[model samples]
Target: MKKKIRIKKALQYFGVPAVIDSIKAQYFGGSELFSIKLDYLEHPLSLRLLGSDVPTFKKIFIEQEYDFHTNIPPKVIVDAGANVGFTSVYLANKFPECKIISIEPEAENFEVLKLNTKPYKNIVAIQAALWNENKKINLVDPGKGSWGFTAEDSDDNDADLIDAVTVDYLLEHYKLGHIDILKIDIEGSEKEVFDDTSKWLSNVNSIVIELHERMKQGCNRSFYTGTPGFNVEWQKGENVFIARDEEVMSPR
Candidate 1:
């Protein structure tokens, strides 16, 4: 399964034409419900990212409307595990006034993330892992199995590691008083990020997270309750929406 997924990803990364060719070649007569094809370019500003072109788990999150319970239109957004920075760019464009801070740990991915957000001045891209503590730790590369980063002791593939910081530390360091919307999609490390972020949750107005139920390091499903904001719906998708309860805005 891992090999097959990797091959598919490789073909998709190649281009839209390669993706179409691979699908037709493999399935022949079968029909796929939907698919996204990214058109990567050599130029930084020319790079385009959207649900129509990029096959990512955050597509659903982008389509959904926030349940607004306050007058605040999300002046600040924290995007953890920004991947290629599509979501950060999207939010920045959607809310021009909002300040977006995207956190990504992988070296290669972080470069792409920075490039993708280069056109937007409101977005700040950081190349580091968000952890429970403000210290550096070794990371595990699961080849093609999962893009999720974990502690080195969790896996023994490569001996590479990087520095990390806590959410509270980031808020304090950046002088961000309250977060309007916080989106976390750090593969499987959502548990630790949330567990160690109790000090900052009270000020967060809205949250959308991608929960991994089946993880070797125990899923972080338990930490969802401590948050004070609104209790939104949950579906079997990449990310789930949890809005603030004070002002419930019906989905348009």
Candidate 2:
């Protein structure tokens, strides 16, 4: 009789995942969008910032591929929180025909994002924040505690009111009736942004979101997921993707 393979023994003998990851990082010099071999999984695995610090673009590319396999080519992609153009670059490379609007409000991150995406022609870098309406919002980066721009830290001094616009307003102002993919990573502001999503939910085909479980405060939006017409696949980590089976939702 063949002996059962003990999980811990097997992991130790074959080298644990963390050890393997360390070796890969040292050998590969951080990861871009590449088919990386990991453990027993034959499928390619994506490691965040494999070779660079905060590889935002690479992370987005890998995250989107988790469950999003659309045959219909994307026409436009809206990146609500383009940190350093990591995802923007990946999306542009994947869908060369698609136009990307990368929104970043953090001054420090925006500088990097702009430089990183400068080589791409399809990406439009907008240093702003999306809200329920068009207005100025206090931009705050609570250091390592948060991952988005917000008004929470506004002291009414040294605060910049970024241009805030709803998805509907953007579609109408830009004369775009449809958005192929809407990727939002606004830290915890997704609740407010989603509150107005109903206006354009029917126009969007696919949505990728990173829900901040801790950001539930001050948010009044509630999502009805896994319904008959709505299809949702929730990734363990804060990321989630939602799509419509019948028709895509378009704002404006």
Candidate 3:
């Protein structure tokens, strides 16, 4: 069943035209990546196919995550696991006044994230894993670049250690009194973050997360259980929306 779903997802990722373009790009070998300039936001973005062309505009702009109808624009937005910085760019355009900090852990993905968000001065791209602790940890590279990076407890000693930061650290480091919107899609490390939302949840008004229980067991449970005061709604897709005030949802 999982194999079948993966096949369908791969088909969707390629569709018809992308497959042809991907093949051409492979042979030409001029640039490994492609640039996309969005007309709506006037934001330039770069895309690499290793699950990094990850469509997020639909959820950000179309779905309206940080948008508050009450005319209270978001002050600060934190984007965890901001793959390639598309989502951070989207948030930057959507809330021009808001300061966005885009965090991506993978080396290759972090490089791309920096490039894509560089044009926007408001977006600060950081290379750090959002985990429970501040210590370094082993990161499992599933080869799917943006989509499948996972954190594992290993004692290999020679294993590459990635710098990590906790939610508590972010609040203190950024001097963020309160996070207007916190979008977490940290692949599977969310289990570690949600392990304790007590220190962070009070300061966050809106929360948009993409849970991956299949990737890390109890991801859904951890988020659901940890955030007791917030209103949690599981959307149609792999994402979930939780808020302290009025619930946010897709208008369409």
Candidate 4:
């Protein structure tokens, strides 16, 4: 049943020929990267894995995880923890005029992200981890594959150091007056980012996040506490959509 559903979705997103090619790449093909061509996109999306990226790709392209309805076209979109630039690419295609900043910590994932987003001029890929402060941190991979990397403060010399930046820093560095859409999937780092939202929370108009309460406690508490005036717009799959007051969704 699950297999049938997945195939159905794949056909809907990638069409018949791409789906068959994907299956062939999964079993028969070896080592070579698989490419997916969508009618809506100008270039084919390159997938590094036959298995690891399928679920993420399905969630973004097929399931439309980040599909939020807004009357206002966002001017600035920030994709924190943008794994291989899937959501960034999706949004870039959806809103070609909007400026998108795609942030990723993992080295390999950042490389693939650059490749995937190369066709879109509106997307600016930044290789860094989103954190509460602008500092160096260690990325901990808890065996949850590529999308599950988390950031933690560490002084150990052997630790994998990754550059971490705050939302405020990004705003200042890029000269963005405000963020219209802030999409966060930074593993368990939401607790830290939302713990004290007084600095940057007010500047954001909307948020779409996947809470990682199972990975780190107090995530829900911090998020809700930080976004007091925001209204819960909707939830699809694991993502929660919130907007800054009900008027944000109202047609201008």
What's the lDDT for all of these models?
Answer: 0.61, 0.60, 0.71, 0.82
1-252, model 4: which lDDT tens digit per residue?
Answer: 111224665565556776676666566764435687877776789764443466798888877777766776889999999989999988898888999999999998888899999989999999999998898899987767778888998776655598999999999899998999899999989999998888888789988899999999999998888887786567789988888765554211
Model 2 misplacement above 4 A: 1-52, 55-58, 61-67, 152-159, 218-221, 225-229, 246-252
- Write down the lDDT that model 1 would get: 0.61
The C-alpha TM-scores of every prediction are 0.70, 0.67, 0.81, 0.86
Worst 10 residues of 1 by lDDT: 42-51
Task: Give model 1's clash tally.
Answer: 5
In lDDT terms, which candidate is top? Answer: 4
Which residue pairs in model 3 clash with each other? none
**Structure candidate 4, residue pairs in collision:** none
- The digit string of per-residue lDDT tens for model 2 on 1-252 reads 211223343244234564455446556655322223433322233323222322332244434343345657688889887766666767777678888889877776677677667767888999887776777767765544224446442324444567777888768877768888888878777767765456777777777777775756644234443112456444534556666742433221
Ordered list by TM-score, greatest first:
4, 3, 1, 2
Of the pair 3 and 4, which is ahead by TM-score?
A: 4
Q: In candidate 2, what residue range of length 10 has the lowest lDDT sum?
A: 1-10
